[model samples]
Target chain A: MKKLFTGVCVAAALSLSGQAALADVLDDIAERGVLRVGVKADYPPYGYLDEAGNIVGIEPALAQDVADLLGVELELIPVVSSNRMQFLEQGRIDLMIATMTDRNDRREVVQIVDPNYYSSGTNILAPTAAGLTEWEQLDGLPVCGIQGAFYNRKTEEEFGAEIVAFTGTAEALAALQQGTCVAFVYDDSFLISRLSEPEWADYEMPLQTIDDAPWGLAVALGEDRFAELMSGMIVNWHLSGRILALETEYGVDNTPFAERMHQLFLDINPSIER
Target chain B: MDGIEAWFLDLYHTTGINLTIVYDAFDRERFLWGLLNTVILSVICLVFSVIIGIIGAWLLGARHAIPRRIVQAYVQFFRNTPPLVQMYFFFFALGPMFMTTVERHVGQMVFVSETPLLTSFHWAVISLSFFAGAFNVEIFRSGIEAVPRSTIEAAEALGMSRWQIYRDVILPLAFRICLPALNNNLVNLVKTTTLAYAIAVPELLYMSNQIWSDSVNVPEMMTVLLFVYVGLVAILVFAMQRWERAMKLPGFGR
Candidate 1:
């Protein structure tokens, strides 16, 4: 029994050391000829599954192009909003191309790539029946939103809105549809995507856009080489007119916000080949 | 008073949006729906886990050593791993098998849609039930062992069958002893339902995340969410304590 126990302990220690000695994620990906990217599989036009069950969207398309430039295959790994950071840190994915906003807290933990692609702002959606025309109109009214969203405290402190927070977009939408809240608060891009759906056509934007936040790709912290590679891919994509092509393909150019976003992208990186 | 004024003043200086935005977002309908989901998930998992636990305890407590050892190993494996890992494995690894099984067995009976097998909600319940069930087995087994062996022997001597002895004496006594621990498990199961958010079940935490991601005021939103969760869990703990007290056996504590 003692000998068997010693053998088991030695085996366990070897396995632990072996795991510790594994190559850095970026190096491994370069050698393997594939970049495993963590992306949202639900958010439409950015990172979502198409009707044929294929993962095809703006982020996935961009990730594929980057992989091609690096001579690697793009392996899209579906990740939800909650676990995306954890996935990156654990080396489950080489990098994240989800619609992740640039925040200080996140920057502390992950490396944010330069030249963010899109700009988004917070906005509120109200049912046509609510007739809420201004922010103050929401005072004393029940508003439905998701938890962990950045606006719950601001909405309460600034507007005295009674916030009912749920866990996901589906629940918030369901609440709005079911007349639980007169309005629902979310990101402008998300609102546009949701409203474009057949089910949400009846809903309209009631509140003006709040803070305009930039979105960027994130890799593991301290991985400066990987960050540089990612930023270079993004810059090359811009110069190659690939970003513009995506905008035209998605018809995002139709929206004023997308036009504004396009201009911002150009402002940040003016040397695009387009 | 000074802090309150400063808070309000800061809000006015910064965003120009008033407190109404909070009220506007508080949809009673959605919150109630979330509450309903929470209760439904908790109750169903609770009942199923108890059933599993009872069976597991019986198997583990049996006279045969080999089978008992096997059951012991099963309990140790599950109980030792983190619940989140188990949830992920079940959702990502085993989900397809369960989905196919549900579609094959219950799809035609329940819904008109072809892909009607195993909705996200069903998967959430199953994952939580199995995770909780593993722990329940250990708790119930311990409770059963705590029962005096003399009582079971006396029932058997009175010509009562094994099943009758279990049903009349052992089960009641074991159940009473297990009440406090069982209450803690139930409360825990309720909180664990939040894991359903990862699979996009539209629970409370998922919605909050969507909101914060949009708003850019993560600290404020997170603080409120912390309070909301704390309040919800506290209420569950209080109610469970009451139930535990109600089920307390006389003369036992003294």
Candidate 2:
């Protein structure tokens, strides 16, 4: 047993030492002259398409920061909630700034940096006529949801909602408009963005939001050097009040989480200029 | 029961292999329900498709040219176009037309209307049954053509009415002749039930997708889904084969 264990350790050490030079993505991003980042192409205020068909949003801008840090050109790869982590794991993208929820299961698959970048809670986009005032009001009624949202099961199980999850926001919105579902249970941030539009004028986010979860940006697992670099960047972003500025620039309401994070970072290092 | 659930949870914790259906009660119940829904959907579509096939193929021999032309158009339209588009048309374009407008309050989001006469599930059934029926019509047509004119003439000469002749003589033989093709088409229809996921029917694929998305156990749930579908299709094939054998010509051997 000792011989077998030692043999396996020797093999692991040899493989690890042999590939040590190629392991650090922080250096590779600099050497490659292009940093590939996964960003949501359809989610507004995070990462989405501009009228000119270019990918623009807060997340893409953050990705550009990483590229700038490495002194490399930025390349944004469009990803949906479902495939973003897989893309990072497959090494198709060196970094991921998509609006992914930080969960223990997800952390097992991808190296989510400490100090999350953003947060959103679950809420319902219901017609004003629906008069939905409480989470319990969703019981037994059909609620449209994006397929990959983390809170879909929660809404169904806790509130007894019959979730009709669709593959995209467009389809779910159509279902909501068609009255196939009385409400759409989705991220409050995205719902708030939609409410600003003239098309969603009559709908209100009626219920109190629930299940608030912070969003984490991630790199592929074992990219510890890159993860460490991103940790510092998140701290810098908080200290500089960059998140708040981006919220204003992107027309999002300044969230309490952002304010708290900024204050917390200031306490840690009060000398940084806002 | 708790032990089994705990075992699955422990399995997930140790191996980093999460299978929510086995461990989570809500997911397991829903997954089972999803499987049942798929079975119900496939059976309903299969029965309806066969009925449509038999009727439409028989209509091809109608004394009126208009009936024949109508059948021709239906087959062509359904066969040439996509089922997914047809489902969307039925659900989005045609469905809302039947929905009565509720009290129009202010602006857009309050545009809540009642459910249409046909739900998404009903639309899926209509779309898929017709889609498979179109192919079935052609299949049954060829099966009908293979029936000898002599036997049909004998039945006609023996004072069988047009309806009786069709009911007794043509249908049974044509059905037997087309059993293999019908089996193939029914199996395809069963597989096509997955398309209902797009319209949010909560079939096996949709429910499994829900589980995977929430649990972040894509590979594990996917494996489960694959095997369940394979098992479902195998059951279908077994039943069809038995039906074919039982209905075989008395002295015939495969």
In terms of DockQ, which candidate is strongest? 2
TM-score of 2: 0.72
The CA lDDT at A193 in model 1 is 71
Q: lDDT per prediction? A: 0.70, 0.85
Q: Cα deviation of B196 in candidate 2 (Å)? A: 1.0
CA shift of B19, model 1, Å? 6.5
Against the true structure, what is each candidate's TM-score?
A: 0.47, 0.72
**Candidate 1, CAPRI quality class derived from DockQ:** incorrect
For candidate 1, write residues B1-254 as lDDT tens digits.
55665675578469753332244334433444555676677778888988888888878867789879887887887788877677656654555454221111121222111222454567778878877888888888878888898988899899998777777887778888887788778778878888877655556665555544654545765676577777877887887788777878797534
Candidate 2 docking DockQ: 0.24
Predicted candidate 2 versus true structure: per-residue lDDT over A164-273, tens digit per residue: 88888898998888888888998898897898688999898887667778999998999866776677678768879999999889877777778888998787657775
